[model samples]
Target: MSIEIPGYRSGTWVLDPAHSEVTFSVRHMMISKVRGTFGVKEATLIAPENPLEAKVEAKVDVSSIDTKDEGRDAHLRSADFFDVENHPVMTFTSTGTRVQNGDFLVDGDLTIRGITKPVTFEFDFGGFGKDPQGNYKAGASATAVIDREEFGLTWNAALETGGVLVGKEVTIGLDLQGALQV
Candidate 1:
């Protein structure tokens, strides 16, 4: 006996930012975790037959970062961090993908403040289904560790208690939904 499996087809999928989010959390002086999210961003995935062959790209507007604190958010967009005026956009382009035990590891180049570095995220496939309006949708989530200093976000202060402010490792999370076009 022989068996066959259905494969993904060629199409351009648009990310539903309204339902998707790019969020992060970083330790503050090894004490508390500071969490924030980027609001204005978009991503596209082109998966043709094989998810590994997909081309993924994402663009995030620096000024759209929000931590729910006006003062901190403003400062983050200033010269110390994202520097929204000079580098308004941060982007990511996938280099390749690997699947293991029903999960994916996507390796990509992330560009921030004119600096480009490779990063890989462990992705969870959220199953494929069609919406009520007949739109095909697929969901995925990924997480990765990043160094803020690598992106030139080195601004910090020494805490009166003991340690220096901010942490070296930043955790990034992505919850994405893509609309497949056949």
Candidate 2:
């Protein structure tokens, strides 16, 4: 079955940074998971004349990486991890877009710590509505799994029980909200 998304016109859609979030989770200590969020510096969606050709681009501030603990946050910002001082921003640019079985497959280039790789995320059109301020808003949720090592984030410690302190696989989640350009 096919359902048409609402308020998605052939025009630019500006991301609402205050309402959208990019978060991630990864296995920790081979037992549980650790989650965090990155601050989006900017994000925009250019609706192509052909709906399937839409492009989404975004920049995230590495310095805003937050996992709750200040000490761990500092370590993540250091060279051993994100090296936020040297690489302050990470970016993503969509190469292709398509609707499949009522969902969107956004194939894109993800750049992190100066390394770029192709990745695809499956997105669901959550809903569309008017915000409190009367702006027409579109909402979506996306998920993708990526290897930390692929992004040059291979730092880890050997666990006494046999695994590693951090898991190589990271699950990315995006709860996105955007408004149509007037």
Candidate 3:
């Protein structure tokens, strides 16, 4: 069966930062996962009929990385990790998209700490819905993994227990919802 996504016009659709966020998590000392979220400052999505032709541009405020713990969050914003002062924004742009078994695989360039790397995330299509005002909305969720060292966020400490303080692999989750303008 073919699913019809409400057609979007050929224009820029600004991401609703109020409802969107870029979050990540990593294994700490190989026993627990430490999670944090980055506030999205801006995003522009140009979705065409062909998923492969769809493009997304997003910018995240590095200074907004929050994990609820003041000390940990501060360290994440420092030079050892994100270095918010030097690299204030992390950005991403779609390169391609593919469908496998009815789900989307979105390939894109993810830039962090001045380093850009290609990453792919599996996406789930959330059907179009409408608000009380009759504005159409569509949503999707995706997840991908990244190497923190590859992005120059290589701060780590050796734990007496054996493993390092933080794991190299960082998992990212994206939950996006946008308004349709057709």
Best by lDDT: 2
Which structure among the candidates has the greatest TM-score? 2
User: Which sections of candidate 1 miss by over 4 Å?
Assistant: 1-9, 100-102
lDDT of 1: 0.85
lDDT per residue for candidate 1 within 60-115, as digits (tens), equals 87898989899999999999888999999999999988776755688999998989
lDDT tens string, model 3, 1-182?
22345553444556767777788899988999999898988887886555467788889998998999999988998999999999999999999777778777888999999999999898876656776888777677789999989999889999987989999999999888777665
Better of 2 and 3 by lDDT: 2
The Cα local distance difference test for each model comes to 0.85, 0.88, 0.83
By lDDT, the candidates rank as 2, 1, 3
The TM-score obtained by model 3 is: 0.91
TM of each candidate vs. truth: 0.92, 0.93, 0.91
Residue 48's lDDT in candidate 2:
60
Which residue pairs collide, candidate 1? none
Ranking by TM-score: 2, 1, 3
Q: Tell me which residue pairs clash in candidate 3.
A: none
Return the lDDT, model 1, position 1.
19
Each prediction's number of clashing residue pairs: 0, 0, 0
* Candidate 2 clashes between residue pairs 3 or more apart in a chain or in different chains: none
Poorly placed runs, candidate 3 (over 4 Å):
1-11
